[model samples]
Target: MMKRIALLWNVVKGDARVLWHALRQPERPVWLVPATALVALYALDPFNIAMPLAGVVDDGIIVPLLLHVMVRCLPAHMRRA
Candidate 1:
């Protein structure tokens, strides 16, 4: 029973390490972009602002623009051939 638990723990740790390494690689810039956007949004505090422009800029413009860019940037293999 103890050996089985140790094996399972090691397997989980190995998988986490693999994911960490993948996120660190240069080819995965998309992962970093979303995180930066989130940080910017938080710093801006769009919700508390009294103006409609803030909501429009954050939710209406930036969010959809980011989604559009992400959709276009998806790998060719992900799209129907």
Candidate 2:
């Protein structure tokens, strides 16, 4: 059990390093534009700030989509086993 935990931790650490590098690259992610727009919309909106839809979307769709997009956007070398 300890060995499995160690292995899982190592994998998570390595994957996080790769993701950090990919996201920190000079090139902006494709989703950044849309994400920024969404943020701006939220920021600019004054009435009815209770955004249940946004919370639901982010929790369900956006989170997974963002993760998928991030992995896809990684450099081939970084993603290589």
Q: Which numbered prediction scores highest in TM-score against the true structure? A: 2
lDDT of 1: 0.51
Which pairs of residues collide in candidate 2?
none
TM-scores, each model vs. reference: 0.35, 0.42
Cα shift from native, residue 24, model 1 (Å): 18
Worst 10 residues of 1 by lDDT: 72-81
lDDT, residue 76, candidate 1: 43
Weakest ten-residue segment in model 2 by summed lDDT: 59-68
* Highest-lDDT candidate: 2
lDDT score for residue 19 of model 2: 63
For candidate 2, the TM-score is: 0.42
Give each model's whole-structure lDDT. Answer: 0.51, 0.55
Model 1, 1-81: lDDT tens per residue?
A: 789758755654453344345445566557645654664575467573777676655554454444445434545433222
Error of 1 at 27 (Å): 12
